[model samples]
Target chain A: METRVDGRLVRGDQTRRAVLGKAVEIASVDGLEGLSIGRLAKELEISKSGLFAHFGSKEELQLATVRAARRIYVTAVVEPALATAPGFSRVWALSECWLDYSQRRVFPGGCFFAKASHEYGARRGPVRDYLAEVNREWVQLVEQTIGEAISLGELEADPAQLAFELNAYYDSANLASLLHDDDGAIYAQARHSIRARLESAATAGTALPWRSGRSR
Target chain B: METRVDGRLVRGDQTRRAVLGKAVEIASVDGLEGLSIGRLAKELEISKSGLFAHFGSKEELQLATVRAARRIYVTAVVEPALATAPGFSRVWALSECWLDYSQRRVFPGGCFFAKASHEYGARRGPVRDYLAEVNREWVQLVEQTIGEAISLGELEADPAQLAFELNAYYDSANLASLLHDDDGAIYAQARHSIRARLESAATAGTALPWRSGRSR
Candidate 1:
């Protein structure tokens, strides 16, 4: 009985991972509400009940999908920036990583949070609450990075205000890139805006984090 | 039969308006995709076929919903702003109107364009194309308003650049307001940022657009 139980648990975990992997992709484009269980099962070639057993309910499945997307988001946007040491360099690194994440199609649709945030921005319940929490966490991470730079005397700016502005540019570029598919130049323009804003706030005696001649 | 024909036509137009009005509210919250005809008909207490007859397909329904939302958007955000003369005041007015539109929940959710833009941002179809056109029209309107200020020698800034920054603050505040419901102060903060940016760009000789000592 123990051997049989172990085998079943392994199979369940495998199915759960597979379901979530596909769920993130679908949600990235069509949104969480759009990622119906029937569609997920059909696409993954699994029994609807099999998928249902993994999450037990549609709400649970949505939550699991969000968790999956969060993992992917961290890997794509946060981890790379974290790999760089904390300070202005990490802050700048995060912006580059984010722009690249959206441009390179990390989820084959663009930034997961941008899509999810818009999808659940109006609605209430667990999904919206989760997304709102994720947003706070992300903003805090950005503010903390900016704070490191400020404490190092490399820049003189309010961390939260600058974080809000930089995040604005990043999201604006993401939406603009999607709106104008033919224009790959919006990303460069966003990068330009970010660089200029940071440079304007950099301390006079501090070294620039980026290459001096880089055109943003 | 002629009397009956007129009655039928009148009934059809009434239903069309009803559907579209509901469509905009639903789309604003759940997105254009989430505004399903079946759900709308059920909610509106009309037969699905009767609702479907007004729009031949879901795509047509979506297109109509977008058009309906656009009209409401103009009424809520642009009309009040445009009531002011086309100069520095108008620019500030536009920002105020936009913030009010989102804060007051014109569609009982938030800015319809912000929600729909993110919804169709990655998707391709007539719906997405139309949204893109509306966005271009909107950004152009902002740019034109700024241009008017520049022409009047009230502002000395690039219309496109100023438009982008102003638009960014508008959206950032909208999203922040939604995510942080308890923090009503975000709107005032957004206004502060907008005023500051505008002041920085305003020509030295121009009258300040906001009230004196309003720069908090």
Candidate 2:
């Protein structure tokens, strides 16, 4: 699946990559609708016609930017958690990775989806539709992660409800951190909330992943 | 406090009110930064410089829009909740009003603060600072509301934590409803979550307000 692409575009996937890299960061802070090719070209010190050749329209640029952000999001947030064992530990790792991603300013504007989703969540258009789709996929991933824990008998709760709560904590902390100019304590508060919620939901005899090596 | 303003500028104040009314709706969806004097004047069928004279600058326009939004927020969300007796009932009322506000489309873009706060949350500037201040005021209001519950012996959770969780549910439901296009079911889910959280945190023998009219 990785190798499937047009060979003609390969030599200068570099231009597309650079354009998208800047696009994602700007979109993360300003929004897809705010991305102007003229502004981007000015920032990149490139020809407007050259950039125009790649993305025929502003909408295309926004769409491509969203795709680029998804790739970055997967690498920063999903893969690390996937590397952990599936179940409670994986869920825990997923939460930590997400907090770290936002706390570390992976996108200069905090979580790309958090900013973009809120930006596009209200309007009706292709941009908004793509963001909504991405959000659905992300929520499904969280629910599936929780489902793994529930199926393993380590946790017992409604997957959708737990997913919603945990996602809320993740987003709330992100906004709080951003509001406070990168205050790290908000993430700790989220971690505390996540830990408490997990502890309450864990089965009576299930080993706690967070409390490992604390004394069995 | 209401009558302390300049009586000589009442007619000018009316024009300002009219501009801000439309401005809040536009800013709710497009964003505060997206609010331009020319577009606003064109939409209102007035001269750009006339509107410019009222606001003086783009930043001032954004600030006025935020203030206007805060007024609408208070009326739609806070006033109804405050009307109810303070404590768990009021807390529950606040939740209900917020869900109703979002689910009913009180603003064209759903909750204005949710959209605008995320829009400016990352950047450093006066707009961001004012939005942060508004967020602080809001969170403080939630905490103070929860404090009433705790002091009354109706609930016993940490006020800040409880506030964070409830506010999370409210804002989460708002964003979800927006993404889902005015889906009332999401608001119901939020109500369920809020009810359960409050029920869990309530002191023993505290009446569940949500169940007051329903038969056991």
Candidate 3:
């Protein structure tokens, strides 16, 4: 039996994807508040009505853009690191992938979550709540990764504390790179900080992932 | 004749001070882009023409607001730390004062520079340039403080590297506190990271400032 797909529905999904792709990029540089259906329609050559159909309101569009960005983030940062061997290597890989993601301009404006989170951090709204939830999830993921290293006796430290420090390095590097327009030294500094911090946390007998051949 | 201040000049200066006081608070929360002369004039119960006289353009207003915030930051975070004895105690005091500044909501948000820096980081122009300059100034100050500790044989670490890590912790904690609305634990976590990092760098004979009777 041949399965028939509806072309209109497929087009709708494609349009939504395209809109969100553009939305995330704009929002990364200009903030979510800068997103407008009119601008998107003009830039993308789509009807404003089409965008309205996809997103009932500006907040809805912003929320959808964030979700889209999260998906992109997982693919760019999370999955690559997860593919590595569990334990210290995975943790190191996560940091490398994150730095690469930011350095590579994965969203054309550095880390999407960092920009949006800062923009909405002080505001109380659905967007802020959603970003906070995403942040909590990311922090937990980093903590869990460190917990794996701890379980394997490869690291010795509080998972949450190490996670906090590592995440801070990632964000600080990202912002500095963007602001100072000096991609080279800022990332090198962050890499130095991360490698040194991880070295401190590594157990006495554990092989240092960064010093190993697998290091970035 | 005693130095008599001009009455009209004093009134104009007072108005400028009042406007910027509100501007920094609003910019800290809503971002500099959220600031408008009309909105400020309405909120401050002043004429739009008056704000126009003070700030000929939006960029001028933003620059003034940033300058104002820096003055407040110096008083809140830098001055108190400078009052402490040099070496490890001064470095520790800087961290404590910075955490307190953020936790106390000096700007009714978190760190004013953190929010503003992240807001204008991606954008180019005078504001971004000024922010980058301010950030460099801050990083150098931290580095110089660490150099003092190293000179006193109280700590042993690369000034730039340690400064980057410590600054990262401060910013990460600031953002987390704002987003999570958990001031107490977030600050404790930052303090723990800072103290631990400093402990790692402290010399053998040097007393840890955080462990001393003068510790926060």
* TM-score list, all predictions: 0.92, 0.94, 0.96
For model 1, the docking class works out as: medium
Model 3 misplaced regions, further than 4 Å: A212-216, B213-216
Best by lDDT: 3
Candidate 3 lDDT at B80 equals 97
**Which candidate number has the best DockQ?**
3
Candidate 2 structure quality by residue, lDDT tens digits, B127-156: 899889989998999899999988999999
Q: Per-residue lDDT of B1-216 in model 3, one digit per residue for the tens?
A: 799899999999999999999999999988899888888999999999988899889999999999999999999999999999999888999999999999999998789898888878888899999999999999999999999999998999999999999999999999999999893999999999999998888898777766656445
**What would the DockQ be for model 1?**
0.67
Q: What does candidate 1's lDDT look like per residue over B118-177, in tens digits?
A: 888888889999999999999999999999998998888878777877888888888888
The fnat of each candidate, in order, is 0.56, 0.58, 0.78
| Residue B109 C-alpha lDDT in model 1 | 72
Chain A TM-score for predicted structure 1: 0.93
Q: What is the interface RMSD of candidate 2, in Å?
A: 0.9
- TM-score ranking, high to low: 3, 2, 1
Clashing pairs in 3: none
lDDT of 2 by residue, A1-216 (tens): 577878778845888899999999888888777788988888989899999899888888999999999999999999999999988888889999999999988998888988888888878889889888888899999999999989998889888888888888899999998888755878888898888888889898777777766644
Among all windows of 10 consecutive residues in model 3 chain B, the one with the lowest summed lDDT is B207-216
Model 2 per-residue lDDT at B216: 94
- Candidate 3 residue A90 Cα shift, in angstroms, is 0.5
